[model samples]
Target: MIINKILNVDDYYFDVFMSISESLTGFSVNELQSTGLAEIYYKHILGQIEAATFTEFLNISKNILENSYTQDQLNNAIAAEIFANASTEDIANSIITLWYLGTWEGAYVNDLSYKEGLVWNVMHSHPPGAKQPGYKSWGVKPVNSNI
Candidate 1:
């Protein structure tokens, strides 16, 4: 039930983000947004830290979305090249890195909130202090891992 306040766009924008993220990260929206991570990404791109921003990243992503490509197009090598190159852009790369590591661009900025980071999700491990895997399961595989 969380709503976006920064961009003021409708559901389509989130859908775009979901689609792009699924393509890039190979994770479902239900999986990725379970802890409101995507919205945080949107906030980061909009104006979280001002100088630390991704307006250009969002623009390039939206431009790709605007192109005449089908959902299947994102999986192709050409589109992969575009995404790969776009991710090289400062903001876009940070976004991709965040999607993978679930942290902000510490290489660029020191502020990083790893509360719901994707690495823990993918590794089938819970956030260190938030959700304990269970009793004495430190090295055991997570019971509910989707990866």
Candidate 2:
């Protein structure tokens, strides 16, 4: 990938990547970073997409985030600037899917990706057989405070 070829691991690209992901996924940077999959996902995306396309996408996202003052404004800008383009829309969707499902286009990125998926936390559940909610725990309704 061009990013890996040119930029070091500690480059600002990763910070930009995480910020874009936070906007796309509606998850905080801390939450996404806690998954321990940011670098993996960043490299995976760079490998899948052309360098110019990825760079353009990130640049647009950065601009939108910078120019928008409120969260609603930011979201509107992202919708207009990022998701409005076909290629960028696909990349954005892939990013959201990567966060929620830990899969890129239906294929798991890594073994840990599945176990660390955001969907589990969102649903207040664990990946079956991985975390094991406990024997027969499914029989009881989930105690979701938010609900």
Cand. 1 TM to true fold: 0.60
Estimate, for each residue in 19-134, the C-alpha lDDT of model 1 and write its tens digit. 55655677766777774667767656555445323444444455665563665654553255454674434554566677767666463222234656667766767667767677
Candidate 2 structure, TM-score to reference: 0.85
What ranges in model 2 sit over 4 Å off?
Answer: 1-9, 134-141, 144-147
User: Which one wins on lDDT?
Assistant: 2
Worst 10 residues of 2 by lDDT: 1-10
Error of 1 at 130 (Å): 3.4
Cα lDDT listed for each candidate: 0.57, 0.83
lDDT of 2 by residue, 23-141 (tens): 88888888997988988999998898898888988888777767877889988898898888998899899999998999998999998899999999989889987888989886777
Models 1 onward score TM values of 0.60, 0.85
